[model samples]
Target: MTTAPIRLGTRRSALAMAQSSQVARALERVSGRSVELVQIVSEGDASRASLSQLGGTGVFATRLRDALRADECDLLVHSLKDLPTADAPGLLLAATPERADARDVVLTRDGTALADLAPGATVGTGSPRRIAQVRGENPGVEVRDLRGNVDSRMRRVRDGELDAIVLAAAGLSRLGAEIDLVAEPRDLAAWPAAAGQGSLAVETRADADAELLETLRALDDPRTRFAVIVERAILAGVEAGCHAPVGVHAVIDDDELRVRAAVYGAQPGDEVVVDRAEPLAQEYIRPQGSGKGADAASRVAHERASGIGALVAGLLLDRGAAELISPSTAS
Candidate 1:
């Protein structure tokens, strides 16, 4: 008897394909299941409008999810950052595989760091969080809106059209972009990754086949899931979208988990940073008769992380950070 190949849906972009290919290969290796890539072109990819104008949430993920719902695909792969916070009815975020480096790196023309760039140097980025952070670092640098694939952005810098550009380190790595002048953000005030940055979301329908769910669970990493859970929880607690001018990062250090968040208002001067670290002492549960023992740990860890995230978000909001991102509160 032959096993049917699992259909994995992904966006049409190169970076999307690269990431999906990796997951497909891994799934095949671990489960001995053949995998097929189903290319999906998202509205975000087809639209020329700015991401902010598109509501910045679900533009890239919605179509793929629709395909999942229609049973056009068995599984969907998405950049966890692009996956919105609201729970999609009849769908499950089945797994979050091991995360990659979540830092943002500055790519320069002459291999010079951001600090070394001449005053008024044009830096290209499309993210409000990145723009605010870059401007905060160097007030004189001229930050400009940028869009397109990794190659096009890099080409602009190479051709001297842009002095520098800041992009997610994981995307650069996945696309194999040869980055020479790289600068990592060392401070939350200056830089923090978006919630779920550098992570992959494996989503499946609520009624997905049992064997497929088991295969996906095998790829899920508890620590990565916990970190993204806390980060996303902070976004949800703040009632902010994934594309909001907010940066969040979570890390697991041995028995301690630290969650850091930064909120940048509509203006450059309006910003706040909050960080919280706590002991990872969530109660562990091992379900009887289930072959999976780690599932319980994953759920407990996410719960603890969510609580910590809510605490951190509340701290910032109390300090008036909410006004920065809220349209009603904006001056």
Candidate 2:
């Protein structure tokens, strides 16, 4: 008997298709099953309103998740950064593949860096975090609201309509887009990226079949998963949405996990930043569910990582992150 192809749900954007295609190929290799892409229109993709106006978080993932819940697809792929910190009913994040570059890049018509851009130069981006970071770096430049796919946004800069635009380097790499503009990658230390940036999330129904679960779990990279979990935990701890002026980046180096987070107030000068690191437990470093002790180890590791995240968030809140990121103050 021939097996049915796995239906992978995804958005219709070029980047989404590219990343989803990549995941499809990987799943086919691991499961020895054919995979097909099922494009789904999300509200975020359909609407022209600013992300903030549409509500900062979950705009992109909601519809695809709905399709999954409705049995329209067997799995869904999402840009993890766009996914809300909150869990959806009946869905589980089955996998987090290896991460890509989690830094923001400045695309300019000329070779001008963001800091070197002439005062009053216009930089386009719709992200509150980018807006605040751009302003903090060079308050003289005029930051303009920008929305659209990567191609359209880059076109504005190429056509001289905007001096530059901030975009995720991971998106560019995934799309493999070719352009005639200069790209400058920002330092993560100075400009932390959104939580879970540069990662791809493979989601599926919580009660998926054992074989399907195992296949999806094969794609999980523990290091990437742990880091993103810690980063996102901080986002959740602070009660901020994905589109808020909050930047959190976590990385696992050797046996240590380090995270840097920032919450920017509406004003350029108003911000709360925190940097913290912790040693990773042995079980988290190893593949998940390798032995009888695996379950207990995974649980403990998860709690410890979450605890560290809460600790950092507490530090920020204690230092006025709550006031800095409050909706009334942040926007």
Candidate 3:
């Protein structure tokens, strides 16, 4: 018997559609059920205001999440970084596929590196984190507020309205957009990305069927899920919204998970940073998802990961991260 297709809700932007289509195909392969993409325009997509002005954290996710809760869609795909850390009522983030590159890249009109850009060069980005990072790297450059789809933002550089722009490398790769400009990759060691950056979040209602949940679980990459959990835990611990100037990156190496977090002040060169690593729980290092025993192991691993994240967040707060990342200072 043929099953009904899974309706996956996603934003209508080019990047969103591309990534959601990938998830749809993957769901089809794993569940042997067809999937349909439902185009949903979020407030973030419809608004002209900056992310900070739109309240940052849930602007991109709230509407789509509402659709899932109301049974308008069976599942939803979200750019993980755009999702708020707080859990939505009656919703579960079902899976996070293997991550793409999590680093931000600098795109320029004339093949000039960010550092080589002339003094007073105008750099455009809508993210507070990128604004602080750009200022920290080159205080002389003029950082301007910008919002739009990827193509429109790139057009600003082409039209000589801005000298450079910062964007996530994953979006460009997913869209397969041919960028003719010089794209310089930022070093994650020094320039950490937003929590859960470059990851896709698949969410569904909490009351989803056991079979469907299992099918979605087939898409989860334990390592990717663990990393993002830790990173987002730090974000939550600090009580900073997604729009705050906070950057967190986490990676698992062998038996250890290492994280780097930064909270930037409104002024350039004023920031609090925390770098920490912990040995992963044995269950986490081993492969997961076999049976009840594996499920128990997964729970234990998640607890340990969250504890480590809290520890790092405490360290940052001790060093004044809270003061630097106040809501009023987000922009």
Best candidate (score: lDDT) = 3
Give candidate 1 regions above 4 Å deviation. 180-190, 282-297, 328-331
Candidate no. 3 TM-score: 0.97
Q: What ranking of all candidate models by lDDT puts the best one first?
A: 3, 2, 1
lDDT of 2 at 192: 99
Q: List model 1 lDDT by residue over 1-331, tens digit each.
A: 3389999999999999999999999999978979999998899999867777666777899899999999999999999998888899999998888999898888875667676678989999887778877887777789888888898888898888999988888887888866655455445334788899999999999998788888788788777888888898898888888878889998877778877788886565678888788887534211212355555565566677778889998988998877778552121
Tell me the tens digit of each residue's lDDT in model 3 across 150-269.
Answer: 899999999999999999999999999989778999998899999999999999999998888889989999999899999999988998888789999999998888899999988998
Quote the lDDT for 1 in model 2.
Answer: 32
Q: List residue ranges in candidate 2 displaced over 4 A.
A: 289-295, 328-331
TM-score per prediction, in order, is: 0.92, 0.96, 0.97
lDDT of 2 by residue, 1-331 (tens): 3378999999999999999999999999989999999999999899999887888688899899999999999999999999988889999998999999999999998788888889999999999889999999888899888999999999999889999999999999999999789999999988999999999999999998877888888898888888888888898888888888889998888888888999998788899999988887666767875445755776776777788888888888999988877673232
Model 2 C-alpha RMSD to native: 1.7
Q: Which residue pairs clash within candidate 1? A: none
